[model samples]
Target: MAPSSPPLPQFEEAKSTTSTVLWQLYHHRPRSPRAIALSVLTFFVLLYMLNTSSSQSEPNFWTKFPSQHPFPERPEDAQVALPQRNDITINDTLPHDLEKPNPQLHILLPAQRSSRGSCRTITSAMILGYPPPTLIGYGHEAHGTTDFEQMVGRMKRTLAYLEHSRTVKDRDIVLLVDSEDVFFQLPPQVLVTRFQNILRKNNKDLLRKYGVTTVNRPGPKTAPAVVQKYTQRVLFGASKKCHGAHATDPGCVSIPESSLPPDVYGWKTDIHPDGFLNRPRWLNPGTVIGQAADLRLIFKEALRIIEQRQKKNGDEEAFTQIYGRQEVVRELERRRTVSLFKEWGYKLLGISDATNISTINIRLETEHRYEYGIGVDFESELFFNQLLSADDVEWLKYSNVTKTSALQGSMGVPREHRLLLPTDVAALPNPFNYSLLALNQTTLPLWNKTLDKLPNPEDHTWNDIPLMTNAHSASVPVLAHVNGNTKLRNTWWEKMWFFPWARALLRRYVRASQGFDAAQSSLLGGADWWDMRGGRGGVWTDHESWVRFADVCQGQERDLFDDDLGPWGKENGDPDEPVYNEWGNLVYGKEPPQLPQPPQLNDINDHW
Candidate 1:
């Protein structure tokens, strides 16, 4: 204690420093505990607000491809070994291998007699060089169908052909597709393999035992994988919900005109080739493939439903099973009724009997898990009205749902046969998974150059596969659906303003196709649709069909035949006169998008 004093130098130094710190803290504006807590909370709140705003401003899938799964870039030098000049195809521009046929498969298309918009569909098949379709509903005037009667007409004829005719055996694949919109990306063998994979059956042994050319049935009681995976002999898929008039209230069976803009709801008049149609929530029957025997039953059921609906509704044509007529929906709207589905018909009182349906929905395929990306329908984000999330591409299938009490259960679709509503779209009721579109999200993977597991166009360069040189995994949607505002949304414009690549893609396909003058900048003019249809707009190649089919893909289906492109071929400020290199398009410009150096397509490699 004797001077614990006067302390040491180290002690003095520490004391001085401590004093300085205390002086600063004492002089500095000190806050209460509550004030400090509030300040900290405020900083966090500001940070959260900033994050929310930035996320909200991000562009949706409509404009940009998802970062996780971007579009695939085209292979620079993939060459295909296409056959020599053969059958005429789309744009009357493509050369097909019709002379050399794939005898193992039977591709069926119900075409009109040079009347269904310039025979572009048939020409597409011919250009692809697949064998001619059985040709159902030819020569007859198109009375028009509500739910794919053209296909139904062909199905009936095909079934008849299969029932008694010895030509179609169990081994033969019978593919029914939308003639014009879809292009044959690969050969029949490839398609058969895809079908077998979807079927999820052990048909390799049976296939090898019978040989690819000849198909024999397994012994009685032994079900074929074709019948198993392609259950009920049908295949299709569902797309995102379109925010048309019907979406005002998905749970409501009918929406009134008052709930929608005139252009947003069902058209008051029959503006399309087929009138009074009811679109299914799921199951776009654009392209369906199956064995002949099983396919016959699916067609038969569809026909029966059509007949029953026709008889009860008092319409000679227009065959839609579950989806009711425009009048029916309107009447419900007037009544302000709210139900999962609309009634069959006011004229007929009782609920219709349940019918059988064999659908192949890519949207719900358990095997693929419904991966996200564009298919034929490019407006999925718009339809869903939301941006992508981790769970966006969940597995959806018929086994997912339980019951359908209304005509959404038309023909009283059997509980087992009916497409079960996917949980994502079921808020609207009766949402099934049907993506049978030509370029569905599932099917497009075959052409996606981005996926490592799938075969790249470059790997098979100078091989047999018909390479879609213009195919951009991220840029180009598989189906390239001709969709957009079209006077419905603020984004609608005079130009096509749809799947931007539609015209280029179709034109590229025609160029990539064999036989047509590969060198001709603008060989000739197409007869219908947008520009390709000889009217106005920038449609080229078989894009005429692309625009034509857009109407059918509508939500409420306001108009199935709408033409805003002035007069076809005139919308682009060109007089109906065909001119090459107009600006820079292959048709308008002198040079193509740098000759997509894809070689002649032969057959694909053993790679998936």
Candidate 2:
């Protein structure tokens, strides 16, 4: 048959093709089992490497895990009305049915007598329409011989006021500052809004850092997983230098890094001979803000540390130690919940450990004891601690949309300093304005024609500029703590926007009844913090007694008042006098005038 096919060309070609196929099949024996397995393993290894590298680059990846703890609740949310943008207008006369707002703001300035600087703090707060501060340790001289002793006295008195006072509720906001150093820059509205906003932002970061999130539960419900909850409720001013501790102590070395950019201080960052280039990571007791309840806890813990140590240590040391320990505990909890493989991944990625906190030893009680929700204003969003950071700030006006960019650039302001758009800045309403015509819809002017045109020629328009801003952090700090170069206090105080018309502004603030902006209050989760009674200038003492604002500020007129702007009282009033009331009453008698009791809330909407 082959010989017959050879005679046919088609048959011979088919035979040749079959032979070639058989030869290829024989030579190409199934790849060796070992080689195939090795190849597959290499492919998987490459894929995993790629996946891990990608995740490492993403900041949030491997940082999120479901939290096991419950979300904290605010009781004020139920009592305060949700703010609407147009719910209320700035009015000269408050409604008769107005009631005390929920979670009222309480300022605490502890001092023996109001100094020029302390008086400036009081005057600024008043001008900005803040509630009368409760003066802790006022009229008490000779606190202690040492600086530590003085700090302890202040903390003790502050804690006592928060713990025993009836007027200050647990939820009420309390701002405590160094009586002679700190000064308010922004209004209470901005302070409250920024505070809540900062807390929210910080808490979000804390949650991520702790690798905690919320996830779905068994059914339609959702719940936090087996993880710890980390949040920041109490914020303290941040400083570049650590006080009351040695360079290598946990207080100095164990604090978390500041959230500010690495180059916030330019080329000298962390390398300056004076330590001015370092980040603001240390806790500053000079200025702090928190709820009354949280404040009480932190103060109590600090005082306990001071008493237990029996050393010359102060509240600053105690606070620093506390913060260090809190971070350590948080890191321990974070690692405990995270997977071992993730830990290895983190090590490979060069992410530094939380802190060299193992050197710090403290009794780890319930999480609540260590976790006072203590956090620092690293960005100076709420408070600026001017220690080594004196040169980081400048005064620039953003209300002028056309000039803002040029001003920032010419002034050497960092790009981060212009975070707020010119339109946003220009559109900001003057919180101090309290007329029917002063609706929230009306934006502040770049020049303030009425104030700028005053007969007395001064370079500043109080309505035009905000106070000292930290260009490094892009923060318009609510208050400034002049902790460094004591002489700067006077110079910086003069730079304040309200320094020229403080007396007049203070009167305007007190004369208008305290009310809440629905939109702003809503930002604080419906907590009305502006609950001041109209027409008053009295400060509640740590002993629960009252003192006249005029009495405290009598000798401080030179620093707080602009005589050329006229007196704080009615037209043609004495320019040098301190007027405390609309009735022309110079001072009240032994018993202080009683604030009107809030109208009974027959219905929830009655006050509204």
Return the top candidate by lDDT.
2
Task: Give the per-residue lDDT of model 1 (tens digit) for 1-608.
Answer: 35555779999999999999999987997789999999999998865554342224333221121112111211111111223333454367333323212223555555544332223343333323344344444445367564555545555665676666554554345666544344332333234433444333323322322222212356987653321110112333222232222322221222111111222213532233332221223323455555555455445545665556444222112212212222122222222321213323422555422221212111211121111211121222111111111112121222223322332243333343333332222231111111223222221112222211222333322222212211100111112112222222212111121222222233223323222332221122111100111211111111013222222222211121133323222224533333333253333323324565555445234332
Steric collisions counted per model:
52, 3
Q: Candidate 1: misplaced stretches above 4 Å?
A: 1-103, 115-118, 142-155, 164-166, 183-189, 201-233, 241-281, 311-608
User: What TM-score, over all chains together, does every model reach?
Assistant: 0.30, 0.71
lDDT at residue 351 of model 2 (Cα atoms) = 78
Tens digit of per-residue lDDT, candidate 2, span 78-99: 1322353344455534345454
| Model 2 worst lDDT window (10 residues) | 438-447
RMSD, each candidate, Å?
27.4, 14.7
Q: How high is the lDDT of residue 454 in model 2?
A: 27
